[model samples]
Target chain A: MIPATLNVYVGLSALLFAVGLLGVLLRRNTLVIYMCLELMLVASTLAFVAFSRFNGSMDGNVFVFFILTVAAAEVAAGLAIIVALFRKRLTVQVDQLDGLKH
Target chain B: MFPAIFTFLVLFTAVCAAGVIVCRNTVNAAMCLLLCLVGVAGLFVCLEAYLLAFLLLLVYAGAVVTLFLFIVMLIDVRGGAPRARNPLATVAGIIAAALVVGGLASFWVRGHLAAPAASATPALGASLKAYAYPLFTAYLLPVQVLGFLLLVAMIGVVVLSRKPDPGPKP
Candidate 1:
């Protein structure tokens, strides 16, 4: 049996979210930024499950089902876009691909 | 046994996520993400979300990370170029991130719901029947729409990955 409280789980969620946000802000690699976005999504799911379990409802769990499905599709599409970008520009670094900065 | 496991999972997931940010090599970052997903699955199990936990492992750890690795290999972008320190952007990004962290910390300090007593909390069984009923009932339309969305995504990926025409820049 687990002896932790809800606050503990929420704190973990907050911490992960902060880390993901920091990565998105500071990291220049598009791939790393994308991975950090996924981290944020997963952290949100963890909080959802914790709330669902602690509140004794299935709503949170069901939401995670949808999130997982959507995230998979998002990853597929996003990666395809990244690959296409790489082929067109030959660089995955964000700063080097600045064609629109007039 | 479980709390100890939960603590370990939390630490493992956080460390791996941070590694993704700090690692210069794209492949190394991808590997960190894989480990992070595994740790998240463990955390899901701790929350008793048995099915979601498995799906996370199967979909995220299995498919998504594999796709990332494949892309990294194909592009052969081993390590990111060393960043030139831009003072303005660095300051702005750091300030924005700090604001977000501060907001979340404040939310935890004051706004989070008080956890009810464990014994008083109702038991939400992590069973398939409990999940399937709602997905098939209340969420049926969303499910159908998402199915359509997935098909659209598949078509889009196919279109995007095709070779561009052999013409001049328009």
Candidate 2:
């Protein structure tokens, strides 16, 4: 019965979100930021699932499944792009990735 | 009994999340992210959304994070300890994190939690029906469109990663 409380779920999701945010802010490595982005995605998914549980609906679960699929395809493509950029630049620092400079 | 599982899962997730951030090595951080994903999947199961949880394991844990690991392996990541010259940033980060968590906990502890309505049982069933009906009928367009998006992204990635054309003329 207590597990059904929305506040508990939201709090945990919020904590995860904060952790991901901190990682994004504090880390200079591009790969670490990418990983933090994944963590953020997971936090959002958790929020969706928790909301679905409270609403007594399964739509959130189905949506999360689709999100997972999208995330998979995304990573495959995103990582390929990251690798390609890294090969050309030799450094994955975000600061150094400005190709539009004159 | 359930409370204990919930606490354990939350603690596990928090630890992994911290690990992902605090670890200096990018590869280790990626691995920690995988651990956090697994913990989140466990939470999905706890929420009784078995299907979502399994897909999370198969797709996110199995495929996506592994792809990340492969990319990390392919790159020549610089080694040596990360510089710790910025103590002020570190202190500010920890204080901000603590304040946010503490405030949320206080709000939750104030007993504003809502009890489920009597009709909640049927609502779950209704939601399933709602999901199924539209999933097969009215909402199929976006679903198919998402598939197309993935296909395009995949093709674009392959093209981007391919070697440049060898033709002499531009």
DockQ of the candidate models in sequence: 0.62, 0.54
Which lDDT tens digits does candidate 1 get at residues A1-102? Answer: 335678777777877888888888888888888988988998899899889988989888888888888998899999999999999888888777789995
Query: For candidate 2, what is the recovered fraction of reference interface contacts?
Result: 0.61
In candidate 1, list every pair of residues with a backbone clash. Answer: none
Candidates in order have lDDT scores of 0.85, 0.77
Docking class for candidate 2: medium
List residue ranges in candidate 2 displaced over 4 A.
Answer: A1-4, A98-102, B79-133, B167-170
Clashes of each: 0, 0
Model 2, B105-151: lDDT tens digits are 78767746564742354334223455577567866876898889888
Residue A30 lDDT (model 2):
83
> fnat, candidate 1?
0.62
Model 2, C-alpha of B101: deviation from truth (Å): 4.9
Worst-scoring 10-residue span by lDDT in model 2 chain B: B118-127
DockQ of 1: 0.62
Q: What is the Å distance of residue B127 in model 1 from its true position?
A: 0.8
Using DockQ, give the best candidate's number: 1
TM-score per candidate for chain A alone: 0.95, 0.86
